[model samples]
Target: MPADTARGRLPGFFYRFAHPALAVVSTVGSLLWLAGFALAGAGVALRASDPTTAYALFYYGSLVSLAGIAGIAAVVAYLVVLWLLRDVLDVLDWEKPEPGARR
Candidate 1:
């Protein structure tokens, strides 16, 4: 999903950090995500320019792209773990209930 749509996230569809920190992390993650698309696109375009070079470029691009995705997944895993224990961490929470409201 586009970074802008982070605000569009519906309650309960997914969990998110209620703190401002999530904004910074989300933006950075989105920008870093573009590397995958760029590499894959370059690989696609290179194919018509030169067959032999295209194979190498595509091969490496695919590897790099997959690595980038894996890194992102790892980060998400870390955040998920933290989020699940937000009450104990006392740092971030997915939502803030109203005053006197039950969580």
Candidate 2:
């Protein structure tokens, strides 16, 4: 088998750097989403006492939540594309050349 043909193998830079970077992004996205929900809840609690403040909190919280969701979606889409490409490459057997062929 070629060096790149091992199952679950990724390029060195991707495995070492890109994957970890995406993981961190995913973690941050989730945290931001959670914070948005907390803020929105606070807005709801304050709605009766301070309508203007509540509206601002709700609006900003929704924007933050949407941004977080978009970030996570983008990361997931990238990963899915990577997975599909890997599967297609595996199916094509592109890494294995003729047995006697020279490198």
| Model 2 CA lDDT for position 76 | 97
Per-residue CA lDDT of candidate 1, range 1-103, in tens? 4554646654323344444455455445555557657766776888887778767766776666666566667667877888677866766755767899853
Q: Residue 32 error for model 2, in Å?
A: 0.8
> TM per model?
0.48, 0.68
The candidate scoring highest on TM-score is: 2
CA lDDT scores, all candidates in order: 0.64, 0.80
> lDDT per residue, candidate 2, 1-103, as tens digits?
5566645464444456637779767767888898899889999999999999999999989988988898899899998877777666554333644888765
Q: How high a TM-score does candidate 2 get? A: 0.68
Candidate 2 positional error at 87, Å: 0.7
